[model samples]
Target: MEAFDIAGLCAHPDDAELVMGGTLAREAAAGRKVALVDLTRGESGSRGSPAVRAAEAAEAARVLGASHRESLGLPDSALERTVAHRDVIVSALRRLRPAIVVTQHWDQRHPDHGMASHLVYDACFMSGLRNYRPDLGAAFRPRKVVFATSMTETIEAVPSFVVDITATFETKMRAIRAFASQFSPAAGETVALPFERFQESVELTARRQGQRIGVTFGEGFVTREPVEIDDLLALRGRSI
Candidate 1:
């Protein structure tokens, strides 16, 4: 097993870059081995072939300093929580052996994003079971799972915490720009949802999250359990 400090499961090639690129970049810069997993090839997207998306993803990973990135090749726009769908992630969890795993929030406008969240949640539990899927690899479960809410225009829930990405905000933009096929809006184009001013969408969301925490740039994350604090005085950043 190639132990990783952090591993993020994304619904598509650019999902992580859009939402948590800064967090990933910051962690990588702090000497943590960060990796990314794209659940689908994004063949169903409006623009960009799978090959083009994969190449862009590779470049984005390089820009973010990720140790590596893998794609499960799951059917695009057809994500499900079936056993087979979950097995691939189970195998990957065992193979990579990450200490922390991050994925999309369960509540999302896109069904695939929600499905990916559930799939990752189940895979994490199953991967820890020694008797379950023994053929995959040794049992290993990440200690923490984080949910990112920056993918959507409306954040429905209050963030548990916001990462101050002020330092790496530009780095995040560079990574987002790597997926030129998707983020680059063509001239004289008016559209909806993704691909229609997608780059602007990402930037606006980041700015909103940053303003909440009184920072130049920020990425918000949610956790199931309360974050334990050993010393209140040691906690940094002001209240929103």
Candidate 2:
């Protein structure tokens, strides 16, 4: 596969779309090479089988215009921070060599999400080490690692930045809906709640975030390190 500009590394198949769909769509629409790496096949999800979810994920990737979508085959709902697991992620990072990586927030309600956050962060650092895993791929480090909010019941901290995704909001929804097993009642699959309610909640969150930045729709992300701005005028939402 070709190098990606940005990569979304998440715990489960639909996690990326749930949290950063709009951002991914916007990036891909802008002709930036974007990829998604799902840590697991979401086999533990109540609604779908692994095979079913895999197909759904592919559809979602297509809708989002992602350059590549892959799963690490990690145990769902049972993610751990181990050398083997970290090495797998590190290999992918070196192979993709994305300049920026987006992952779930460190503090999350789901254990897998939290674990994935730590795993991705550590792997990013390890990927930079020349001797970490020479057999997998050449050492390469991503420039930035940003955290996107996912399945968190509360917003513990304010976002460091918000990406305006008004133009791609609908496209994001379409990509999310591709996971019919999780969000579509007509798919004859059991879900935690009605599909309509789930959709409404997602839209509501996007709307609230968008309101924060005076946009119709947006996605928020937090960065552990302070973002360096080359020019204030170049920043989004800045008046020329």
Candidate 3:
């Protein structure tokens, strides 16, 4: 219920950590309040039960140093941009009143990810309407909405900005690995790659994105609107 400087809204429990864990960690480390809101309990996941996923999500939140975490218990994979759904998210926006919102990219391989993006985008707009959902809370809207890349491979669309996360990259991986059910193979369950190899792939992806902005590790984000710069000299002079 507390206000947060940044809020992450995503389809499943681990989506936030996978897409922008380092950024979240960096924010918290810098004394910024952060929260995570999962649209679903990830009940329909192939490996973990909903309760297990919830516990894992809690652990991950701790690793990221988030102030709070909540789940909407929405139907996983079948999420839609219904008025009811929007109202729920609108309520959260009004309650948390985050200055910045981080969510899954609009273009993602998973249908749920894309649907979640639409749901958050619409809810953010509706939340600002004074006449809308008065029963939820006072109307409120986030100052900015940023999309974290969910693509596992290269994509045509380039990121609007990249956050240097070299210092928090390891913490990000720690948060992700908290979901043992997802990244770690259970007994008798054959995983495509060992946990170490899977982690290496994630690190490699961060390294590749970091190379874009001349950092050791980074996270990419896209914004629909152009970012404003009060002073051009304030920008990091890192080679593009």
Candidate 4:
């Protein structure tokens, strides 16, 4: 199994880039292996085909400096908490052996996003069961799991930590813009996304989140329990 410092598993191709590209870039820039795993091809999306999305995802991964990217070949917009779903993630966890895993928050307007959250969480637990799914790879689990909170209308996540992304914000934007098919469709596309000035919205949100931590840009993340801290002097988010 190839060991990785960070692994991101999300519902769709652009999900990882949208939520945690900066954190991934920071880790990769520091010589840590980062991997991205998508649960679906997003074939049901109003804009872009699966092939186009896959191409864009590859480019985004390159932009973010990720070491590996792959999809689990699950049905888009129809994710469920099933043994089969858990099995695939368990196998990937065993193979990748990532120390930390990042995923979307459970509270979401998009049903698939919420389902993906539950699926990933359960899969992480199942992966550690010694006898669970013996046909898959050996039992393995990530040391930590964190949920990313985006600038969405339906969610109000209180972040446990905020990653200062001032340096990597541009890289993250470039990664997101790689999906031209989704953001720049031709005439008569009629996409459902309210993509008007999405770039500005994203930037503004980052700036606001950054202000919370006295930074220029940031990305917020949440965890179910308290984070373990060894050194009280090592905290960075406090505004001094």
Candidate 5:
């Protein structure tokens, strides 16, 4: 089987960029294959049009140098945890064949984000079963899966691993700012703060995670199982 590095699955348009853009940029800079899959198009967002969001996503992906970025066409805010959704995610997993699958940690704030997490987690398990979705073509089982924090709620996601993206922090922010439609509001909007202020909320959360591990910027992830390594020294080179 041809192995891949990281495949990120999320609910909204910018979830991956908000959570792991730094790590994704760093990984791609290192020549690792990274793919981003969105469960929904953020069509229901109060901010921008779908076409505008799609354009912004493309720009953000280019900034991150992502190998692939696509959406599953699931309902943005009305995502449900069902076999239908699971089948869609399973097909992508089989096709991408990632060594590490990253997604949002379960959060109660938004149903779409939370359901996206549950659906991906279940789909990862179902993807490994040959009998579950055999007619789809082939079944794929990834070695590991990690969940990114997508909400303000403290999910208590004990990190099975961490990636230090301090060197790429500036690049990450630039990539995030590429979604200008989402970050900068249109004129005549009397909102107390611009969208970029909300974007900083994401940055602050990541910075907090970085502080936990003695790094300038980091992304935290929770795995279903403990991460195994060939040598403990592997961790010595990077912040975990």
Candidate 6:
């Protein structure tokens, strides 16, 4: 059997890192294979060009030790959950054949976030069907699928799993910092809330989730289906 563990799907260049970089770093440190697939290049982002974004993504992936990272060239905010979109994602899944697929929450402050979540969810299911978009070649279903935490406060998502990432927290910061074009305070670059501000947000989110599960840092994931556990006690050191 193949050993690839996770494929993180996100809408923009840094979305995956922003949401679950700490967890990803922890997984990679444990020798788990992790790949990042960005639905769009963040081409329409308020800051940085496509080339810069691509470079930043590569740098971040290197820091996180991701097995693979690629962008689908999908329209930034104009992405549609269409057959074309589904086919591309399905094809990617068939190629990666990961054990678990991670994506964004269904509802979010940004339209692309919600659309990307729907697209990834539908594509994962469709990738398992034999008759859907046969031109993409073969279909392979993932063992588990989970969505990342969103930035909005109004949405409710009960996490089915959580990864304690306290040890790799600094590595996650390094990965986020590698996106210099976006976070760097260059004169021509777009004004973000400062790199430190963004990092603080990440720190707060991780600490809040970690507190619930008695950890120093963590990343939460909500499963689309019910999670079956062989032993609930195995979760004693983990989170719900």
Number of the top-ranking candidate, with TM-score as the measure:
4
Model 5 lDDT per residue over 87-203, tens place: 899988888889888888886577887898899999888999988768775878887778875343746565655678788888778877877776565687677766667768767
Model 3, global lDDT: 0.89
What's the residue-level lDDT of 29 in candidate 2?
89
TM-score of each: 0.93, 0.93, 0.94, 0.95, 0.90, 0.92
Best-to-worst order by TM-score is 4, 3, 1, 2, 6, 5
RMSD of 5: 2.5
Candidate 6 lDDT trough over 10 residues, lowest sum: 150-159
After superposing candidate 2 on the true structure, give the runs of residues whose Cα lies further than 4 Å from its correct spot: 184-192, 238-240
Clashing residue pairs in candidate 1, if any? none
The digit string of per-residue lDDT tens for model 4 on 1-240 reads: 598899999999998888898889988998989999999999997778899999999999999999999999999988988888877888889889899999999998888899889999998888888898777888888989999986555966878899999999999999999987888767776655556678888888788778888899999999998988999998765666
Q: After superposition, how far is residue 56 of candidate 4 from its true place, in Å?
A: 0.8
After superposing candidate 1 on the true structure, give the runs of residues whose Cα lies further than 4 Å from its correct spot. Answer: 183-190, 193-196
209 in model 4: Cα distance from truth in Å?
1.4
lDDT of 6 by residue, 1-240 (tens): 343698899999888887788888888888999999999999887767899889999999988889899998889998888988878898888888888888988878888998999999998899999887777767788888888873545575667777788898888888888777776666665654877777888899888777768888888888867778798677576334
CA RMSD, predictions in order: 2.1, 2.4, 1.6, 1.5, 2.5, 2.4
Tell me the spans in candidate 5 whose CA falls farther than 4 Å from its real position: 1-3, 150-156, 237-240
Error of 2 at 85 (Å): 1.3
Q: Candidate 2 has what TM-score?
A: 0.93
Model with the higher lDDT, candidate 1 or 2: 1
lDDT of 3 by residue, 44-153 (tens): 88888888999999999999999899999889988988998878899889999999999998787788888999999999999999997699999888989999973444
RMSD (Cα, Å) of model 2: 2.4
Candidate 1 per-residue lDDT, tens place, 1-240, comes to: 599999999889989987899999999999999999999999998777789999999999999999989999898899998999999999999999999999998888888999999999999999999999789998998999999978654445678888888888889989988888875456876556564466677777888889888887889999989999999998887764
Model 1, position 213: C-alpha lDDT score: 85
Clashing pairs in 2: none
- The models' CA-based lDDT, in order, is 0.89, 0.88, 0.89, 0.88, 0.81, 0.83
